[model samples]
Target: MEKTNSASRFVDLVQTKKSFEDIKYWTWSEMLIALKQCQESPSLTNSSIMLKKCIDLLSQKISLADGASSSASSVNSSRFRSSCDSKSTESLKTNFASTTWWFEDLLFFSTECLEMFVQSMVSHEFDQVLLSKFLIHFQKSKFFNATSDVKMKVIESVIDMLDTLDENVLSLKALFDILRVTLGLNINKGSKNRLEAMIGSKLGHATLDNLLVPSPYGANYLYDVNLVLRLFKAFLSGGINQASPSQLAKAANLMDSYMVEVAPDPCLKSSKFLALAKVIPDSARKSYDEMYYAIDLYFEMHVGMSEEEKEKICCALNHKKLSYEVRIHLSKNPKFPLKSTPSSPESQQPETENLLQNINYSKSLISWPHNLTEGINTDEKEDKSSEQIVLYHGKFDLPADNERFKVHLEGMQWRVLELEKLCRKMQTQMRKILKSRVASSYCQVKSLPKLCS
Candidate 1:
């Protein structure tokens, strides 16, 4: 009998809390140990149910005590217990249990216990925002520098938490941090694919700095190209693209900037660079000037990088899309393999051809005041092209129009600046022509006088 007692005590795990009617009587560590043991058992679901009920009991007790406290302060300093205590009225005790009553205690739980707790809270339909904040707070308390085996457990729990979150409210920085932590763990890629999707869905909202997830030490590449590549593919795969061109543009532009930043790293390979650069469709970018700039930077740092590779990279840039300044720069770039002459009709229209027409750009820079009530008409009057307006937001609550409206406004501003520059150049040329004609007329007048003599 003593040996049997010793065997059971050796395990020291409390498998069930069926006896604890009020969880306030159960110590924090006692509950933690009990839950951890429950996680390994077949009756996990029942244990979770019991754990939740215990939490509910604890909240009711605390809340009721708080409400029924000694607000009626008279001469009440006696320590003797009242034998015939009267129950507080419903009006005095709201009996309201807070959802966050369990958040603090959850901090000490292992990843497994925390995940199960989160699942229970979510099943109860708690406010997702509050829950997400608690998770973020819980994350800050964890030791990220823990062993690979430990990190893998943490990452798995994080991914599970991410799965339960509303993507709209999922913090992008937190997502990035999770990926950053997994860099050297060498865990199975399949496990993190969900993380890629989570990051991708909201890729448009991400900043350049956040996208710059570096490769772990000993990695041949300077940055984690494959990770970002998967994210890019996942972003495109998700149907969020239907929303607006501007957000798509934002992602493409972000990728372009990322390319530029990573280009200078000597260890980065040409194929990897192209892999990321090519993920953004050609039509998404407003212009290839940034892409061209990134390619140029890549070529500059990687001198031995093959001419064929340079040509392949340059081929991705549509010459017509290159800004006038970029065209000039590319033409002068010694390494640039000039396939087509820089004098393309699309790049520069003859002055006489377009001089007759004032608003001669592709689309008039007019503000097409599209009313939200009016259904979007995508006919020739509204071809579903790059300029098609989509919903976006800026400072404060945006008007019924989306952020695409902001994109249109920015395009108009750029066109206005270009027009302004053209006007200044025309004024200078006109002044020069008038000065030359005057000098010729004066000479002719002097010659006429000489002829008369």
Candidate 2:
């Protein structure tokens, strides 16, 4: 009878519309024990209802506490605003004095409630607003600045939440906020500068170098590149070398692959392209040259133009006196070689001069190829077989493969060398064309009679 009365009192408490503070008298473990006993009994309809009420009250209390703690301190009146404004300008000094003790209490309560809530078997709807509030509060705590043991607890809680959450509308925003906080802390300039300065003068450079290399951090390579590129552009514009030789080389390699996938719509802004070119190191100039070669090759193969015809069109287009319509018409012809023979001596004089000018332009294009060749080595290493060598007439020789195999190997080597030569040649010609275009613009600006005509 005493037990029955105790059960009745528990049911009455559950059914009552008690504030969360009132329910706090019953520990979560005790509540769970009561709830389990009620679920086991067949006649406890009121007990089941009471159990749900208790869970709801606990959840709400946890949520409310989290909200009260984490939100930015509000300035409700002119007096409060004046008080805050009159405080120290530095955040550290201000936060130390103005910090609320209630926030710590709230976090403690919420953490306990959350642990209890997870243990309950009740299917409760995740309160997104409440979760967001908790996260906002957590960030405000600057929990990382705390003792390592406390920091570990916070980090563990965050990781657990990240793993379990459904990542729905409510959860995704919370997760993004968490990620922002983590990344912000790691890459914070003030924190990084102090640590780096303590190590050595090359601290910043070393940090950037590690970021460029492949690792877990490389998972964010695209983001890193974008951030670095912005920094690099600022440096270039300010005439500073923000990137090292190897860093620029890595960037060049990335750009080589990136440019191929980029659409060639002239309307698209390519400020990154210009910035990349400016920041690339002299050592990695070959990579940039190769990229330009590939671009030219892509245009040639896809745009239906032979090498000779492209040369002719490029040369003619660079002439200051050439009209756009005339150039376009000339480019449309299949056999309009710039140096084709003239019919008469009277016509040949002007044609000869034009021919000489085109020859000189072609000679200029060859200069880049010569410069590229000066630093390149095309020697092939000899292959050594592990098999025993047989002496024939005092000369040591291994057993030879079929004649066709030897021929195929030689052909493959020749093709690779040929392609390399072609790439260099095309790069040189493209550079010359670009240079000529600049010169033509300058001549037009000067209003030279021969060019302006």
Candidate 3:
């Protein structure tokens, strides 16, 4: 009964507010207090009423502000009775301009109120009407033009609701719809950074990866795949270097999925791979594997390209050996099988035979200086069936100073070198990917109709 009176009084206060001062003096403190009471009480009927009143009050203030600013030229001379009344009109505009700070504050308070209302609804597990209204307003309202800090709070609230365990999947889906709409805005830089940090903390690998694929939002509202890609790019490039390992792994998985979902755009794919490589910690073996897998999958998908197209890609391939940093990690268990196949059978056989037959793979290095030819003892003979001469770049050191340990180390080093070859091939593949994109872009431009500037 007390909650009912409080709710009725809140509605009366809001409906009676005619100016900024009235809103400030009438609702702010009383509304929060009434909301708290309603939260504590078993019935949220009053809380919902109070929240709706606040929303309506905010909308009324915004409408007044908009009218004051926009009607300056549209007002007729009859509207101002005399010079004194004209002064009053000018004063009204001045007051609206001066009260711009109230706009941001109102938005911030509304978001807070909405967030509280959402929490109450989720906790009570009732009041779908309030949730539905909030989502609709958040999705389509002009309140988004408020200050960056307010925008950040709004996004923060949505993400908080998404992270809440009490929130059902339907509520989550509604929040996602809100996010998809929110993300479409040209958010300020500060808000984007804050948002990325929130996403890293809240949205994990699976969530991000699922975003890469298009989600069907019923027959009327199909989720845009391009928008999801833009969001993914924002998450990655928006200070993603500071993301945690788990976030990095999720980003890697998202990139992998992006490769498959988007049409064959080499530049986009390569950029994602390079970005993933830059952020992924060297210790993140699973992410590295995903990166390689994505790259290998690209090559596999494009195996049907013409011979000329293949040459165009392969011509950019770098024959440079792997760096020492990569070689060291190669010796660790960071190796994953390369899923790439050669462009042709003819190109495949020689490379396969060369890699397999010649245990001294380093000696077969094409990038080696021609002046170092004399260093190779061509006259040396080896038992092909028995003692394979393994080339060591420098002295090997192990904690155990035993011959058996030395043999094991040598074998591991050999495998590492083999992995190094694969890494180099991947680097070459990266160059090819970049070149292919450039070539494709050029062809597209050339195909376009010429126009006068």
Candidate 4:
């Protein structure tokens, strides 16, 4: 008890700093070295005392960077600029606009340590974008040539902190990169499925290349067709009510391009290829030319496909949606797949369902922005309950037509875009001010060299 009291007394003095009249404060360089020493000792880094101190020091470093850009001086010894990795230091000199200078410093830590470290950062209420950017950087570096097992661990670690991020902070490309790395890895099936679901929720925004995931080793196929199929199913699982027509169109077109790229793989089975093609609804395809060419490519590569198999492949296409040139080409081929037989009802069932579901979905969508601004600014249930109360108490009638409702949402979307632009403008002005402060801070240093050569 006496020893504890003495140690506590020293800690309090170091923390409070009121009694120390003469002190030589450690630079961020020194503090960072100390922090790294603690991080290397897992026991110390995990402990509350060490973790809190590390968090406090990191917060100050970031604050210092934010308070002053590196351009403030040709050189400085006091803060983070001189203390961090040399590459990071040089990068900072060139990129004065970015306040996130610490992202590069923590890239070398193990995934387990990063998980704990990132969780700690999240707890400290660090900037959400900072956390997200670090995760992205970590993902890219670790997943570069990591084995399947290592990739799984990385995914698991990233997923934990990724949950804390607000929507849109992490880009779809980054998520797709993670998905690509995680694919074909022998991880838990449930975890992979969940990852697919998470990525699918935003798959509408995915570029065509994002869907081109390669098959695992030993597979004859060039790409993992099954993964794309599962992703498409997950994307559609939310139904038309959740996805606007434009988003659906984007996904369908992206899948069409993906099929075209993978169609030449002779080992790709007809059933697997057709399944993905058929999953796309007819209304979603503005043009079937790409789909037709993909089917044609598959036919050329795998000529042994039976008549029924060929018909099944061609059924994914809506002849009416095909352009004049494609229709002419299909008409000329004697063995053209579509020429085998008309699309049977079984083959067209998914499209019919999609159209009917879309009509029902149009009527069921919420008129206001409940779905739009969900999980924002208020507790979801309370926000919805309050909205209902307003509707019940005041005679407010929502637009019944989907078009009018979409217009309202679009208007809100435009206002959001305007606000985002305004926020960006404000950030630019603030950075300019910070840059000026950096310039002023340089002028105040009396011992500084006469001029930087």
lDDT of 2 by residue, 1-453 (tens): 744655665666555634434443454334444555555552655654554556554453333323332322343222222322222123323334422322343343333334344333123344444443554566457474675555545544544443343333233234333433444234344433322222222222323333232212535223334443443343234232554555555555555454443324332123443343344444544323344433443343345445564443233122222233333444454433444212222222344334334433333334444444353332211111111111112322212332343345456555555666776777867578657767887978853232111
Query: Which candidate has the highest TM-score of all?
Result: 1
Q: Clashes in each model (backbone N, CA, C under 3 Å)? A: 3, 1, 0, 0
lDDT of 2: 0.40
Q: State how far residue 356 of model 1 sits from its true place (Å).
A: 4.2
Clash-forming residue pairs, model 1: 391-402, 392-402, 392-403
Candidate 1 least-lDDT 10 residues = 75-84
Q: How high is the CA lDDT of each candidate model?
A: 0.62, 0.40, 0.44, 0.64
Better of 3 and 4 by lDDT: 4
Better of 1 and 3 by lDDT: 1
Give a tens-digit lDDT track for model 3, residues 77-102. Answer: 23222222344345446656553433
TM-score of 2: 0.24
Task: Tell me which of candidates 2 and 3 scores higher on lDDT.
Answer: 3
TM-score against native, each model: 0.60, 0.24, 0.32, 0.55
Which residue pairs clash in candidate 4? none
